[model samples]
Target chain A: MSSITSAKANVLVVGSGGVGTMAAFALEKGGKASVTAVLRSNFAAVQQSGFDIKSLDHGDIQAWRPSAIRNSVPNTATDATAQPYDFIVVTTKNIADIAPSVAEIIAPAVSPGHTAIALVQNGLNIERPLIAAFPSNPIISGVSFIGATEEKPGTIRHDDHDVLLVGAFANPNIAPQASAAAAKIFSDMYGSCPGIDVIYEPDVRFTRWRKLLYNASFNSVATILRMDTSRMRISEHVIDDLIRPVMLEIRATAAAAGVELPMELVDRMITVDTFEAFFKPSMCQDIEKGNYIEFENIVGEPLREAERLGVHTPALKVIYGLLKGLQWQRMEAKGLVKIPLVSEPGMKYGSKPRVVT
Target chain B: MSSITSAKANVLVVGSGGVGTMAAFALEKGGKASVTAVLRSNFAAVQQSGFDIKSLDHGDIQAWRPSAIRNSVPNTATDATAQPYDFIVVTTKNIADIAPSVAEIIAPAVSPGHTAIALVQNGLNIERPLIAAFPSNPIISGVSFIGATEEKPGTIRHDDHDVLLVGAFANPNIAPQASAAAAKIFSDMYGSCPGIDVIYEPDVRFTRWRKLLYNASFNSVATILRMDTSRMRISEHVIDDLIRPVMLEIRATAAAAGVELPMELVDRMITVDTFEAFFKPSMCQDIEKGNYIEFENIVGEPLREAERLGVHTPALKVIYGLLKGLQWQRMEAKGLVKIPLVSEPGMKYGSKPRVVT
Candidate 1:
């Protein structure tokens, strides 16, 4: 057995879905880290079969296994072999579920002085919860431009884009150099992997808002309409009337939050080459499968931020209401919440109740 | 041979679906009018079996047949027996279908000086087309507050209420007495029918705007979400966020059109009885069945009018865009329209196009 070495990094990836698995592969490919992934469901199959990534950039990866795979966060009190990881990568869809919070999911593997948390998820205002939960640990915010889906169990079909933008959280309490150093380490690890390009951003908030320019518009609209980006991008009316307006609202909201997203970003979002590649956004996929959407983190938080900033975002407000209503409807259908009754009384014609028995 | 008498009024009901059949039955029930109906697709079934109205107020009418039922308007030039009718009731859904316009549908049966047009539809700005078509004919605008559905062919399930508000169009060219006389005659004929109450309003524009308060809000929201009024009315958040804002925009638009719809009407629309009766608006039903919606008359006209009048209606604009996008998407799916390609070129990463074959 090899002794523990300070040069090699130990990484723990939580929520081994498509993005999680991709991160794991990228980390292991760097050859400087031992990666472990924690999966919720399909743990047995993934542990036994490993991962299959059919990438448009890289050739098909038949069965790429990580150093270790576990179903849940190892109980540090029970497992003697478990050790604190230097980096914890999170990649779950930010929906409200019975699973543990991001903080709780990484608690067992985090060491205060050494561990850094990387969030590879969609939407805005997501870093707040992590920041609130862990004040001292370095936080890295990652926005992925890859299109991936896990239609088949234990396999990921990655589309043409596999780019990631990562930046350290601008926390006044934490040293900037320390956070930047941690982010660079992650970027180097992820960038060394084939077919993956990781860029270091100085301002993660700006990057997040830039990514939200697409997510806030295309993701929600596609999910709501049950259509793909190809279908949506085909209509000039949709781009001009629906998508552009939503992007403008997000831009305005970001401006209120002290970030000025360039207008060219909107143009780039609508005119992107891969827009007609028949990519169904992850939110749309979740909705198609009757699964819960990451509505709160993606739409709700941004809308709330807009409201708090006293900026009127009519398009975002409308989208949020629609998505919230749909989420509530799903919950009601599943007996998770009680359907509220109509508050008004029955009709009365000429002072007599119009009742039919 | 029957004697030609002015005492026997001649009426033609076009598009004999649920609303059209109900009007035919009510007109025939008055015993003062000889009613003829124009059936479109179900001409054979309706002409052979007649209509079946299952009502909560009046007992079920097993088979109610009009005096004459024809598949199309009779060729007045060829058939000497055909006579111009005194009234033509237009009840087909006001969608932008590939079929003939409403004016053209009733043209073969309309007499320029004598036949008054009754529009029993759910929308705003519908009378403009009729006015443009017939410059001198008296136009009667009617709003029906009845719940009816055609669950089976040739049958209408009428709910507890069957109330109609009718008035002469506020046309400057037409004499008020002439339009009022025709409207009064139609109202008396309809009111005489048991279980149906018809009210004659002098201010027809006010009535229309009042009815639109409910239609523009509940109808559009229901169609956009593919949800019924019962489900929508249950959530106060939906009302506060979506429904009420839409109504307020409609109210503002009406104000810009020199009509002030009272806020109390907005309250009544939300709090009215029978709102929670699982009543799916006609637009919602149209969407579920993959049929075209009355977007122009219901949403587009109002939005355009608001723009013309220089009033801001942001919520309505967003909703209109979404509905229009969905409409175009449906058309594309049905091969009615071509899907446009993405206009931008592929991405270039560091002086090389990122191409994957």
Candidate 2:
């Protein structure tokens, strides 16, 4: 390794969606970190010509490239020259029921006891898998409040909030000091970037639950009803009948799980002025594009938690069921599911089977 | 009135959709009733060409008009020669929130105690409105299990099932004998048709709840997910997760309300072979066509009943909430509800006014 490489921390981002791309940009701006971003569908386009980003927080940036761009995550076992990443910052969607999970995708670059794995994604209970995979490694849980979308391949438009909450998960297997140090180091570097606020929160579980109040309610409703924020908030009874009840249910679930979220947050969340009238939530946008929504993470996981806690969450459960059917529609379209409209002989069923019935 | 009209029972079928037209056809076919149909949007089309029906039970028919057709229900106050009908068979959708309720639409034709009001429609507690309107009149509750759809204006495709459960809703204000006699007369005339089987069910509430086990589950899920029956039953988990849970909720609600629906009926309803792979339920069709769904009657009323009976129905409640939001989309599109994307100065909101916020 070079002298400069020894001085600077190495950071690798596993997903190159709008969030991951922006996270890479912010980490690169810190200058104390060498950033490598793994891109998939937009790899060729970005490699030929980097991201064209128009941001409300950070001014327009044309063709900005990270220190290194990769088509796939680097494997230390497969590649002789692969560097041990200090912080493997993953920003992919926390969608369940996918073929190679996030843990499998980012396993290669992990340097055992050295590299601290940081998850910059939405949803609850997302940190457990990484903690299970790398018991010795520090797991930094991140919650980003950013409004960003890759309008097209390598074309990003970030027009709203850019705050992030990062916390080191206190795994009993690892030293608390080690986890805290790792989180602080990563948070310090990320926080150094302009137009971004990265808070080093010791516990982020409550924060994740706090954010879910809106995500679980508004995002799911918008997708199910096929409306944007403006149209979603169109009627008082829609709020009184549909949205508010869901938010209340989510709050009760959180409270049942020992997190006492305030009632005023519901009002603040419902009236959150960050988004414009036409702004669609990421989940809603994912559904509109016929992509598999992050149903399990955003809605299903919370409902599971509520179930575990013995909380009555009818609103949440119903939304979860509806989303499950909706996500099936996408899976069916992608030929990932076998719809048994007619019976087939010796056909497998469930997630793998080609015949549904 | 003609001599034949005096000899034969005079029946008026309001709202000439598939059900209404079919009811008129069946009544007229019995040769004991002279059927007059009130046509709405398809009045001109039906008046000119009549209904071209392709039925599985009865042979295909073309240009089959009723004995008489009118644009509107005859108002006795305005029309000097209006006949006091024996049975006013109302077959329109049982949607709650509308400008003119079914009672209002059929009020002018009701000859008070002389006319027996027959609701040849779907849903629970539909007889109450008619009972309230004409306290002394006999209210006949009719439930039909038929596969029929108006493909266009007046062209109907009736493929399977021609069974009607006719029962007298015993209102305390009306004599029991009067209610029973009225029900028997209507059932006899309708059942005399070669392909139809009409049973005089003394109490139809239990039958309605049994029917709701299908409508509340499959029809609601189908509309919310925008899938046909075949695709909806494509997966076992989908049935387990969505359809069955809703059926269970409906059953629990029914049982709580003192009507025990059989559990085997859930399986029968789920695997009902009457529908083709492409067959969409009426509610699904209504949603696809942007018409107001029968949310209040089909799903909402049951949920309300469940709430009143103190039955915990998370699945039903969530589906109800989702449908509420979905129905709002239709209401908003039709300019029934004002969407307040932006705050307007002193604008009236809710069902009326143009400002949403």
Candidate 3:
């Protein structure tokens, strides 16, 4: 164990948002890993001045840089001298439709039989693409519950909670016992620090569904309604009529997917997790900032699973539709896609009036 | 029949919106009724200059007014010598939570046993209040489909369609045969003009549900999404996933209420009625203008019926909850209702950090 702790593993964190930065901070502070973060938009500023983090757990952290920083991932063909990464942790928003998918983004550093791909992300059925892309690699899946936001580039404001459930996704190419061993190694290194709470989950799918009970209902509903947690909870009959029904639909869908989330989880999410006044969910914040939402990974993929399992989810269907509409509107505004105008009828009415009242 | 046509009925039209003004215009144009219009906000402008009417059916008219105009509805106690109206046509917006209810607005002109109350409104179970108030009076309920808008104080723009389904509500106090006769009399007078296609529906509850199949689904969905008909329809999977599911819920609810609206009506409403480009539904318009929406009559009352009948309507319930949230937001913005701010927890986290990474 001391020899294992003595040799620091190289971990690469892709998509350095609030979650990514915090994970990097925790991993490096653990002293069990040498962390390199790829900062796309804030590469220059962060390299120049480092991060200024005001966190509930870490208190005030000023002008702190990770062990290493890279603007772009190294291409193996172009740079033959690039070192192999022990783990490539992805912390980006799980939007499946964007160009150069997350799997492709982390392809170069993903060393087969060596690099364990750890996904620190939100959503359901998110491990499929990575698993499909790198069949030989063991995928470390995580469901993180953290209150962290990048107020600006290299500026983070994290709230109190920071809990994560980690497990190995079942991979056809890799042995099941080997995958579990890989996940244990990754989680041990990740939780080596004082601030991060990482629990090893044998069945991460169950854990994923457990987290989705709150996310699929409150997050989506609050975003669509344009209300904060406080406002949504305080609104009359909103919980009983809308949010609770959505949660029940999710619970049913989870059951169909071979997971039984307790009905009590719904009550805990509504009453305990949403106890914060005016706390905006990430999706709500994304919408207000005119950023692209993760409808496909969070709601769409799960809805497809529900459909495959023959579960009826009318509430989820409507929520999915509305989110799609909103995201399309945003895309159109950003000139990402041009929606054609509907063909107008030549005349609004018949040639002659039926009656002249 | 000739005597009935020749007799000039005394008609008082309350709530002089586009629907009310057009009803008044049509009744007077028929040469069978002396129309007295009660105009609230536009009373001064309309009384001073009359209406500048540009209609698709009626063509253009410079200045037009009903036979008589009054600023306010007469109060029986205050105006003891007020004339008793033969029929009071209520065409106002059916907002149930307002101070002066639609039933009370025309209470003074409602002559028991003699005057018939014609509700040219859009909603379900709207006749209940009036039925409760004037038990002996005939309740002439109408489901109107007209494209008319009051652009300004004294300007009107009328589209081509002008169809109405007229029927009488079943009143316990009045004989059924007498109620039918009263509905016939009112319909004849109202549709006397050449442009109005008035269909007498013996089962008006069926018609109300039929109309609600569109209003409760498309209208409410469009408003919540902040998208017009074109935008909503053109979005991918919206009609199939969101709008159609809502219509199915309404259809099931209608079936539970003993009204078998055909499955084909959903197709008709989606394809034909929504053919027009950028057509904003009335509820969407009401939300844009910050007016109180008719959620209670259009979606709320029907949802209540579904609940009472033990029919599950998850889609409708969600739509109802959202509309309620939006309206409450609007009300709070207008300082109508003060929503108390939630008590903030003193501290966000526990005493000590579990881990500080």
Candidate 4:
């Protein structure tokens, strides 16, 4: 067992969305490190009013003090905070595009040995880019189950119980330390947490592809078709004609990549016990909000990968084209607005990038 | 040439939607005889303010003195000058369920040749039941392009210039006297009317199937997916994934049914020429008005037909299921009222039975 060293960690929470706020609350509640939450103007308001957590177990956690800065990626650790971040949590959509020039700002503090980063966003390949950017430090990839929403800056509503899964992208050996630290930090936030899961699965590549297969079939299908999972299950017109083959193609692609995905991955999609039917899917939400979509990351990249792997993704290709066409059509229809359809191209927001994990 | 022997034919335009109003205007503008339009409510107001007709070519032809009645269907065509109808144009959805009841109400003047019934609605397989019920005379299958809206019973807005295409479901020749008479009446309706296109195309089945293909792709795809046609055309997501496969499957089904559709049907969809981004699709309009959809007639039947003909329609089947799921999910999420996920278990809409051609 690694000895418990008396170390002070510096943490920064970016992109004050539901996940971002939850990470901040968890970090400050851990009481092991100093945490600063950076947010955009939209979320900065929530932080200003104070972070509020309406936990299922705790009822509500309120008035948590944390620094909320606007969307600016700082140049140096010392500038955004007194030190560099021991860990930075980014929990936003397609941050690479929206804040390409906005990564420098953070809660200024650093003790590199005590530092690690966790990314808590949906989609397959969110970690490699960050890992590539920060080579020496521990950059953790996290998958979250808890559903949360930030009512305002600093104010967040925890509506459901969600567990966090953490893993190192390239190193299997680091999983134990990362998991221990992550578990301790998260448990202190609210006792009786479901506990954290850390896996050093032989191939992270497969895991990524597996998750992406689900997204490609469920998310893009739902988004492009503008229906929920349950809808796909029930409507004969859609089920037999639209969804099954796409799922089949995705399954084939996974097999081609030598990933023995648990059959349940596809099975569970149809037979899931509970589903949020009307809940606008993440992609649907993007379309509705007219934000720049992470088309390449979520769809294009995977498809290109499939091609390289010599797999036929005919169905996926069709869906991808439809989405791009619709995205373009929407942009053209919007006429003069500088909207991001495929990538968040040249979005000029008035605030800084929010730091979220 | 068939002699125009049906002099001053008495025509009743039943139902208050766009089709009903346009049918009446076509009859009146032709000045071939007496015409009466029966609207449920909106037309009542339009009539009170004096009927407004805005022709596509004639511009705004306001305050035309034509016969108008305000009330629901099944009402008498008996207002002194308005005896039963030489031709009763029943323009209502769920016609199988509604037609039998409507027929009882209008039986007061059901004559043989002088009173041929015409149906102007969307979808395939619906006409058979109506034809089965009223088999005494020719039940001309008419597809209209005259886009009109009776904002009130008294007002008709000629939004777009379109002609009615009339044909028998399976008959190559029946000596279409009524169809010829119908054309003469429509020719006088303002200017630029294509007159009535009475096609006894060698493959009548193909004609109907072709139309079904368009509706299947356009209305259901655009509506359930919440996109307009123009956007659907150019969307890469739509082009590759959604549209192409669906179109191919639809064509396959059409071919299975002996319908020879030109490849241009799809090419036309992609390169709609100057018409590219300016068209308003019905599905988009349906979404805007918050109306329950006619998913079955538009998409459901063709898929079913494709299966009967031993064709593989994977795309259509999936789309079918997704639509049902979305329908139920949307209902479940919207209000306390639950409409059910299963659509009455096998489309009980057109239950009136089929008339042999």
C-alpha TM-scores of all predictions: 0.92, 0.92, 0.90, 0.73
Across residues A1-357, which tens digit of lDDT does each residue of candidate 2 receive?
111246678889998888888889888887778898899999999999999999887889999999899999999767876788888998888787776788889888887778888988888888788888887888888988887888899999997668889888777778888888888888888988887888889877789898898889888988887877656555556566777888998899999888888897877677664233556788888899888898898999999999998988877877887888888889889999875645455522212222211
User: Which candidate do you rate higher for DockQ, 1 or 4?
Assistant: 1
Show the lowest summed lDDT stretch of 10 residues, model 1 chain A: A348-357
Better of 1 and 4 by TM-score: 1
Better of 1 and 4 by lDDT: 1
Worst 10 residues of 3 chain A by lDDT: A348-357
Q: How well does candidate 2 score on lDDT at residue B8?
A: 78
Predicted structure 4, TM vs. truth: 0.73
DockQ of each: 0.39, 0.33, 0.34, 0.17
| lDDT (Cα, tens digit) per residue for candidate 1, span A209-271 | 877888889888887888777666666677777888989988999999999998877776765
Model 1: runs farther than 4 Å from truth? A1-5, A96-100, A273-275, A340-357, B1-5, B96-99, B273-276, B340-357
Q: Which candidate, 1 or 3, has the higher lDDT? A: 3
Point out the higher-scoring one by DockQ: 1 or 3: 1
Steric clash count of candidate 2: 5
Model 3, B11: alpha-carbon shift in Å? 2.3
Where is model 2 more than 4 Å wrong at Cα?
A1-5, A273-278, A343-357, B1-5, B273-278, B344-357
lDDT string for model 4 (A19-73, tens) is 7776666655555555566667654555455656776634676665554454554
Interface Cα RMSD of candidate 2:
7.7
